[model samples]
Target: MKLQVVLVLCAAFALSLQAPSSQECWCELQSEEKAFPHAKLSMVERNVSDCNRNVTPKKTLELESLVLGLDRRIALLHRDISVLEKEDDGELYGVLSLYVVENEMVEIQQMMDKLNRTMKGDQHLTADVTQQLTELQAEMGEMETFDTMELVKGRLATQLLKKDLDNCRKSLNATVPPTQPPQGTCPHGQLVNVTGPQVFTGGEYPGSYLYGAWGRDPEPEPGKENWYWLVMMTVSNRYSNYVRLYSSLSALIVGKSVPGNIIIHSSNPTTNTIQGPNNVLYRGALYYNCYNQLDVCRFNLTTNTVSSFELPKGTRYNSKGNFCNLDECYPYTDLDLATDESGVWVTYTTNQDFGNLVLSKVEEGEPPRLGQTWHTAVYKQALTNTFMACGVLYGTRFVSKDVEEIFYALDTVTGKERFNVGIFMNKMAPNIQALNYSPVDRMLHAYSNSNMVSYKVWFE
Candidate 1:
């Protein structure tokens, strides 16, 4: 009886020695699989694992898309807040704009709440939101802290939102417009002040597709001079592969137009995919920043052939650089294609140039190549849009809801630069998303505030 009891006690001691330590044990699927493999499988309830769901490829992509959408909304929110700040004196839109702001603030809060709910299922994504994100969210949620009068008189709440939105831009890498310029002295002479919002046409897709370009071709085939073209950023406000055509300004205004839905290499991103609103129709072809690559793509309407040439290696692409001011960073505006009295030109900023505007001619050829390049002293982030007119590169900034200042200019001919061009563009919109100069009409076509607005450029 004594011997039997000693044997049983020794067996129990051996089992305890072999078992895992309570403090160090973890519930990994791989670790569990390796456990007790020689013994009969223990009955498990097989509950769905939070860890497995979080690691799924589909779920990961969904989270990333959600994050990007939130980032973009935050930017737009900041832009609206800026508009409210401008209108606080009851000068622009009166207190009506305040109602719009309040409504948008509520929508943004709903987005945050959705994100937080989705994050509860994802531990890894929660880490990405971080302490700073939480703080920014809290700051944004304090919209009700101010009463109507306090909010109207002072911009304290708006200022906090602006600061937090800027932080969001930094977190999402919001960095920073187009043109093929002419040669030597342009035919129209030096571009002077741009006057009037001459025409405002909100097309069929108006109040939507807010980011896009609209202008006549600088060098159209004989009978096509009357044609005005528009390419809305239909995909996530970042990509478009087709052009819509209106026979004339009147036709465009009346929304009588043909769909130029001709695919210019829709399958090949490196070829003719338009990535930003900074694209233009020049000399019977559409030139734009190639989607997903740092290259200039020219899609010849005549041949229907798409050809592209790579930009300078270090040249920024994919929204790494953008036209940004206090309110907003225009999305995916890394490469701008513009036309002038001379010919085709492209503009961008490079790390080597340190965010200053770098201008290069998209040299006209079998496959358009980059030509004589110039670097300017003006910071790209300071301006909202840029266009090349008469061989001179002009830049504009948001002055107010009623005025946009042509605050910077670079005479590519003389290599002369100025920070205060002071040539103001009379505004019809709060923000100019796309600005293109047409040598054909001697006008600047601006896609602003969900409306197609054009300004007559006075030239010396």
Candidate 2:
């Protein structure tokens, strides 16, 4: 009986050893199958890279959806393996019996160890792949963000360019002169029907002319049509007032109530009287001080009275300054006046030592005061001379060691600058001085002092 029992135990042990071989065969087959999915995953990674390189947005989206589906399938496979590990079977009992069981146990232990190592290796590989994918996705997201921002900026730039182009077109269209005048025309020499606020060339009587006069001839004669009213100003003097009138033949002094002039100095060569102009259209108006003692005066055109204003201050003309040419000297000129529908603006230059270009504005109110002030630094050594022409101010300054000319529109009330419509005409010439704007024709007229050459400027 004892021998039979021992024999039975021995047989049982042998069966246990054989069972593991079968189990191992199955595990190996499953592992091999699992490797197919891993290989497919690798191929998928390659395909993703290729798609990223060559596919359109629609195709890329499709491929990403496929990848997500693959991920779901992989998760289901892991779930299956977890379920199998939880099951128990009697056949597995034979695999655990002693002698053959011992041998089988050692083999199974070795297999388990190897399986653990393989699983650990797989986990490491999965972690590495997941990290790589995450990084790639983040990089792609950043690229998309950059692309979006660039698109917006490009659109904004295009819009701005379009607006500027439209403005240029409008300016050009307005420059064309009228073809004919009213049916009945007056003789050229005689005062033509005193046109609506017409601007003409005429003479030099300080107080009589509200707008100043410029000499039409190099050497003006007493009554030889040598001067003209280029612009309107608020001050006037009997002989050297700030305003004057002009016609084609000659300039004359016409007394009018000037609207926006703040007199800084008034002396009679010896005992000059500094009292303000009496019964002026813009008298007692509020204004802001600009460069030097110059101030900007605002007035209501409808009421024929002044309001309040502000302007830039500190710009002054220096007699002993560097020269662009022998004829042009430094501290070219001080603040000139300009006005727009909104308020007043001024542009001025500091002395060569300060090396700055200044612009200022005045707000509309009871007491005129300066508003925002802006300044640009300039090179002292490159300073050049400047001048005012046809009531429009123009100047020359050095840019990159080359003389660059600039132009500005003045605010008649505030002495600030009008940012729009101001242009630099250097390409036209350097010696140009006279400038005039025709309201009806919207043309900018420019001329040289000594030459008969005249230019009509319109936007291109």
Candidate 3:
């Protein structure tokens, strides 16, 4: 009898020794899988047998312990899942890491499903499982469109993050009370103050320019006002070999370059010109329309980050056709992206709209995005270029090269239009290809046939 009792006690001791430690049972992800393209199976610490924990009857110690284990395990599981969520540059098997997260999400979803089935009848267990299920469902939904890059991929990602945080907030609101405050908060947009028919007979800029000699002082934040950027290409026949930026129009004579190069992609940086008259400068980035105006690109001067967003569907890019007035079409000027007090704006006519100018807010983000859109009664084909200022959109027609600025303004605020603004270009080429107004110094910068001209505005 004594020997049998001793044998039974030893058996119980051995079983207790075989149980898993908390770290091992929590199924944390291994260090090796921390890199991109992590496999679904390798992410969790446990294998199939360990993951399929046996269930026990209600009111029993085993059942209570099982529920506690699941709760703790899920808490740890979230930490492992977050490793995949916080990065944008990670890829798996040449695919975005978002897919890897999706795969692992499915695995956890299955585990949650299994637990729900095992604890089906109990009210206490069901509530806990349902809450986790709600969270998992929300997270899974976010990953579905995780790679979508319309407008701005970063903005959409931010929205998803906001949604996730809101869901958590709702849960917290249900349990914990409120703590009051937290804050926070394009296109050839509009044209303004058209002055000038003055002529710079001297070599204002020395390039047989291929259509681009645009200039703007950096935006008027505390330190950036004194610096100006003027872009020009030396060769005009095909594309320029070099796209140069000078401190000012006169600064071009001295031949000084900006500190770092503005690397152009989507087209030949050295060869292809930025494709519109209405490129803009905001914050530290230069926003331009490219790919024949089918796309809008943002180049960050400070970070050197270049991101591009496609224009609306059925918009004419490539300037295969011209942006024409009733009399003639201007070559290579179909899409207009400009900046003003608001930020950035884009002007393009879509085939769906039957070539009517559709103006939209070009917002800044990972790639930039389209915001509120306003359609104009004016036919886009009738305008050569468009710009934005204050809360208005100003459009230009292709008058003769010798003519100064002839423009019309559309108040986006009131949905009103004013014709014959009578802005003129002086000391510049009669064939003005680009025009932008800077709110910073309140000057109009014009790019005409490879020449850079700056005019001070007397806004009436």
Highest-lDDT candidate: 1
C-alpha RMSD values across all candidates: 26.6, 36.8, 30.4
TM-score of 2: 0.30
Q: Could you give candidate 3's per-residue lDDT for residues 226-322 as a string of tens digits?
A: 5556554332322332234555444554556555246564345332236544566677777766533477777676676667888777877766434
Report the Cα lDDT for residue 294, model 3. 75
Q: 38, model 2: CA deviation in Å?
A: 54
Instruction: TM-score each candidate.
Output: 0.60, 0.30, 0.51
Candidate 3 stretches greater than 4 Å from native: 1-193, 197-207, 217-223, 233-243, 265-277, 325-328, 422-427
The positional error of residue 254 in candidate 2, measured at the CA in angstroms, is 15
Top candidate by TM-score: 1
Supply candidate 3's per-residue lDDT for 115.
62
Stretches > 4 Å off in candidate 2 = 1-240, 246-294, 297-314, 317-327, 330-332, 339-343, 351-353, 378-440, 445-454
- The 0-to-1 C-alpha lDDT of every candidate, in the order given, reads 0.77, 0.37, 0.58
lDDT of model 1 at position 225: 78
Candidate 3 has a TM-score of 0.51
Cα miss at 176, model 3 (Å)?
27
